[model samples]
Target: MSKETLTIEVSWPASLAVPEGSTIDIQLWAGNDKAGYSMIDGDFSTPATASPVTLEIPYDSQDLQSHDGTTTWDHFHTSPRLVHGGFIKNIAYAEKISVAQTKGAAWKMALR
Candidate 1:
């Protein structure tokens, strides 16, 4: 299950008004076929510019250990607000990931 092939994009739109030194934390979680979920990867960074910060994460299905037993879908949790002075805005929704997409191919997750 070590499918080292998930791409995660963390970005802040230039149009959004964010404080100068604000930072955001993103946590990525994926679901197991069984009734559970696992945290795949996460990052905390400051978007000092308009370009997106890209992180290459491994799905590693073998690592599934039911971090959250209450959910059956793939989802991510973000920091409540930016570090400096503004609320972080999200542009994407959590979607259910299929077994094939979770174990076979690379998945692209963008958090804006």
Candidate 2:
């Protein structure tokens, strides 16, 4: 069993008002047919320039093995009210991800 790191990049609209050094909480969920589910939460700081922020999350071998080759993941911001929400469909393990909020207050999720 080998462990793998899942990297998720979250972005904010330039027009959005995000104060610098604000705490952003990310809630992530990954699940497969056999593994049932796994959840991880992390916090990151908003860069002064609103550049894309990245988060690295680690999953153990057991979790990876239980994935059954394909997995589905969803993530969203849990604080600061900056981002609305987002989700991803069937994907092979984890890859570079980018999440952002639309101007109309809707959230979007994508794999980068």
Candidate 3:
């Protein structure tokens, strides 16, 4: 996979509910602290029962993910890929990112 191919498609089942009082989000990464990307496009806190929302993330070096009210990617070797991620609160308690894909000339992801 090339740098351009570092795309991720995240979806949740329509039947299941996002954990009550919590939210779900997605992150796309080139590498830790390497200007990754993320977005929360769904009403994960209040999902619909009919259709599973699909979020097509368009990420790149230019559209880097950031915290602290910024769009820049997280800091080098940052604890959270997002600097000011609201989910940081969640990360304080649980694992938000379970799988991650590293994009380069070749691709690899978190193992099962």
TM-score of each: 0.49, 0.46, 0.26
Model 3 Cα RMSD, Å? 9.8
lDDT tens per residue, model 1, 1-112: 4454554455555666655665544556555443334665545454534435554554554544455444344443322223454555444445445545534444444444
lDDT-sorted candidate list, best first:
1, 2, 3
Residue 102 displacement (Å), model 3 = 12
The parts of candidate 2 lying over 4 Å away from their true place are 33-36, 41-49, 64-112
Q: Which pairs of residues collide in candidate 2?
A: none
How many clashing residue pairs appear in each of the predictions shown?
Answer: 0, 0, 3
The superposed Cα distance between candidate 1 and the true structure at residue 1, in angstroms, equals 5.4
The lDDT, on a scale of 0 to 1, for candidate 3 is: 0.30
Candidate 1 stretches greater than 4 Å from native: 1-3, 32-36, 41-48, 65-92, 96-112
The models' CA-based lDDT, in order, is: 0.48, 0.39, 0.30
Query: For residues 1-112, what per-residue lDDT tens digits would candidate 3 score against the true structure?
Result: 1133232222333443344443333333422333334542222231222233233333444434444435544321212111122542222111222223323322211111
lDDT of 2 by residue, 39-83 (tens): 543443333245455555555545422246564343222222233
Residue-level lDDT for 37 in candidate 3: 44
Note the residue pairs that clash in candidate 3. Answer: 65-72, 65-73, 67-84
